[model samples]
Target: MRAIKDEHRAARHRRRRLSLAVGIPVAMAAAAGLTYGTAFGVFGEDAQPRASAATAAGAAAGAASAADDVADGMADDVADGFASVNALGQNGTYGGRDGKTVTVKTLADLEKYATAADPYVIVVAATITMDPKGKEIKVASDKTIVGSGTSGQIVGGGFFLGQGVHNVILRNLTIRDSYAGTWNDKEHDFDAVQMDGAHHVWIDHNDLRHMADGLIDSRKDTTYLTVSWNKLSDNNKTFGIGWTENTTADITIHHNWLRETEQRNPSTDNVAHAHLYNNYLQDVAGTDITSSYGNYSRGNTKMVLENSYFEGLNNPVTKDSSAAVVQRGNVFVGTSGRNESGGTAFDPKSFYAYTLDKAADVPAKVKAGTGPRAATGVTAEAASSTLTVAKDGSGRYRTVQAAVDAVPANNSSRVVVSIAPGTYRETVKIPANKPHVTLQGTGGSRKDTVIVYDNAAGTPKPDGSGTYGTSGSATVAAEADDFQARNLTLSNDFDEKANQNLAGHQAVALRTAADKAFLDGVIVEGDQDTLLLDTAAKDKLGRAYIRDSYVVGNTDFIFGRATAVVDRSVITLKKRWDGTSQGYVTAPSTPADRKGFLITNTTVTGDVSARSFYLGRNWHAGGDATLDPQTTVRDSALSGAIRTTPWSDMGGFPWKDDRFAEYKNTGAGSGTASGDRPQLTDAQARNQEIADWLGNWNPTALNPA
Candidate 1:
């Protein structure tokens, strides 16, 4: 239905439908001489050849009513484009497990349809080979093997039989890696599928391209599942592991498609309960660990990876590295997580002369910072002690919304406004009674400083109906309430080649809506609506506190439905952060007692490390995207470039317990954990519920090591 393949505009609409079906029979013979020239004088006196036959039958019925109004305006422009296109097919169709109807095309006829008391399903469309020495796909327990895609592939090396498998599904199909190992790691054993401790399942789309262990392996309970769209590219050691702790729950993943990819295994394997969305990812930082660990977890766990996307990698995300955890966790990243900053942070001596000789210094100031520490040292002989700011200064405000419209709304006094570095375009908001507004950035090394802009959604506006998704578009919009900012950086530069499903270019580089906001060491890039933190419908208690922040963009770039707290933040990505990242990750415009978007000790990079990403999902919409599941994340750090059933479903319903969880995280995509991580014992993580949504927050003031 999304046919974007135009061969000369569909051959000029088939030669205008062969000139309107041969000009509607020669325009109905010139409409019978225009219906005998308007009925030729009512047939009076021989009526001149009967008035040319009534003007050729009234011009053939007015040329057939102007060709039926040009095919009824192309059938109402295809019924208004399928009524705003959203047929929303989101998978899932073969109910009846063992009522029987199998047709497996390979993998040993799907091992004669394994059965843990009758598990069944094998819907396919093509490619389904697999048999690297036979005996693998041995799934049992309630089963499902869906693939119904035209080009649905599933080449080779897929095996899942870790004993007594339970509810299952192997979806979509496209599991490559026909066994070509030998990186000397002892043949690498070849893999494109494997799920030993399988349980409730629901893999979707499926497309583990160039695999070598792209998707598989979940021990123990195996909990709820729901993988989303699929596509994993290239390969040289892919991943998505889990063992020991064994616990996989409400998993979700959206859109799909990934490139390059690396880190097949950094430390302990992982790919715990997830929910990743959007889709489309390029380069992916030329593989490798790419630093920024992928959606990590261990022991207790609950995951959520928002609208996805992450171009060139290099630590697009990170958290508990060197995997090793017992229990306790909860993870969340909404407003559609993003990535792609490279403005400067991979510090390779200025990127080896900016890539050897391109002289990468696109600088008027590539974020520098060493001039604000003297709002009081200006008296000693008027020395103002190293105070410098004036390329147009009052602490420089060339427009970040005129320093948030010169904050001072419903103030009780607390105006830090310092912004100095540069790149300050516009589009900022902080309304909600500007309580104690703060936006430090007079340079304290947030890599110098910046604040770009690039309005998205086609960037037209003025009622021209362009940028800002919900008809609003953005480029820095706040909603106030103890708002605070730090170090500094916020971009949008929207220009996806000119646009490519960024849902119509709705760009944004920060659009918060108040609560007790406080973004430190900030830096947000853009692709699609990057960084929106909307209180959408407001109050999940509403309060943010993104520490050591950093965000990039693609789609859903940091979504809304507030209640923030992305500590040690750095949730990056390159592309594939689908406006829905597909699977799902914080669509919670919130309601159910309000609670959504709460990334903890965050760090989730993406450059495709085996299993492409997805962390959060099932976010109802204002008035219910299925609220709460209380978005959460604790002591985070997940690598392995995720996407193995994270969590999705904004309205398809099926997410129980309703409160994504994760805890005691480790690295390399930490996979196992129980009771939804976050084992909270130390006085329930500092007076509970992450300090009541960051208001009187105190988690060691987020100075976590």
Candidate 2:
């Protein structure tokens, strides 16, 4: 039996090789079982055929058995790869380290432990503060540097992975304010964390931010490096995949949250191959994932970009004439540019046997699965008890508003409020003093847990703040930081059918001015400015992440100045009762230097007629028409109800100069033949991702699940 299995495996390997050489897709080859070992398995040892017909039937049966074995083997290989998502190429990604543990609390101890050649597990006991002018600390081989909870940190200085460094794992620590000796001089300085000629490295779950120069730079023959579950931000030059000319690097970067970083979110210059998957890039200002090495006329850089989310990014991915980029199942929302200039090609299937996620599923999956347990705040919440609320007066509070009011002011940690299914008609507000609050629905879905109110933009407030402006008319308003809601619905039923032109005609369902606000499986429904996402403070920026939710409205339904990402959600356009024409989808009043909105992996469908709805219109709220109104709709499907002139003018401001773009969208409404829709070049789209907008804030890390 052993010999039979070995023989069949060898035969299948040969068949697979042949099939690959002929350029067949691996999926197809797997389906056919590589046409190997089919005949040998069916015939039993004692069985003998009496006639030619019987012998032929026996042979056919054996072929089928062998094919089944081959298919099973392929399935096994796929399963193995899935289980080893963070492993480094058949080797343990966690570097060589003995079970012996060592505690390092100060800069002196850190240097001593990190450079020692002995294998040891180093636990950082406290934050190590260093001066910016200090020398860099170099880490040696065969060691693990982990933090004790969120207390461990390395501040003001940085670390280095120099030559001969191998088998290292660094995780669960925060590194900040690592300024280069001098600014803006790449030749004279190094990144906050530099990897030069290192091998078998794993860097995960570290919070790195506010560096003067590049955040993380890997160059000079670095191989088998994995950077995952890290929060990187506030650096002008972010991550570099390769810096040395003509040097090849083997690297895989996944599930990293890069926020507010200007450029080089891992720019791959002359690298051999990079596997970048499941990353969230938000509010990134400059070009993202650039592959241009034309200055040196270098070799091709093959990149596999998959299962990533880009929000408020200027450029998403670059596919120049020389580089090879394989993009599959990526979500780009509210981002302006996507690979309009497509030249190079590569296949991700050739290197591995894995399944590609649907673009719509990427946002939710990445949010739930990406990053460390600490960053997501998932582990502690699950292990602790939670508070509950019911609208029917069964337990705790009788209304959602009352429950929200019960939360203590200025809370730092997450306080989850689980609300039972009911429609509470009262207005609700999360005050600015209260932060880190999660309002979760205990029902089956967002529809079952409802919060409704009837108030238009012109409605009078009890406090006499005059009529509620478009920003003030929300039924449910969140005005704090780290606000989160799941499986709930917020609606404003102001009878838009009766008040079209009257009262300014803006009824907001949900208003969020919270920084790091997150919503999962929620709903916001209304007409004319249904969702208001903005910042309360003028000095700071607000960010919101909405995933796997549903939104319905008309006339700038989802409008705001905040850096917002809507992923895997549906935006439905409601038909006007008067039946003249539908209004626009978005009206963004973003700040000049900040990116605006992203709608990715979503679908637009509604009650309107064919060619009735517009996508967006520019809102010159800040009195700057020269500023680019950053709004992107990409990797989404649109219904025929959407018009060919997808963008419109607002208050005499034509949207031609606004940064509005569609990238490889499919559906009845996304036709480019009329030349009205603006498209982004491939090079420009390369830099767009969720990491660009929400710098150093891991939107996925906030998920409770």
Best by TM-score: 2
Which ranges of candidate 1 are over 4 A from the true structure?
1-390, 393-417, 420-450, 455-498, 501-517, 520-529, 532-563, 566-654, 657-705
lDDT (C-alpha, whole model) for all candidates: 0.45, 0.64
Per-model TM-score, in order, reads 0.19, 0.45
Positional deviation of residue 501's Cα in model 2 after best superposition, in angstroms: 9.0
Quality of model 1 by C-alpha lDDT: 0.45
| lDDT per residue (tens digit) for residues 89-154 in model 2 | 334343323324567888888888888877555777688987444356898887667776677778
> What lDDT score is found at residue 573 in candidate 2?
72
Candidate 2, which segments miss by more than 4 Å at Cα?
1-385, 463-465, 498-502, 579-581, 673-675, 702-705
All candidates: CA RMSD (Å): 35.5, 30.4
Best by lDDT: 2
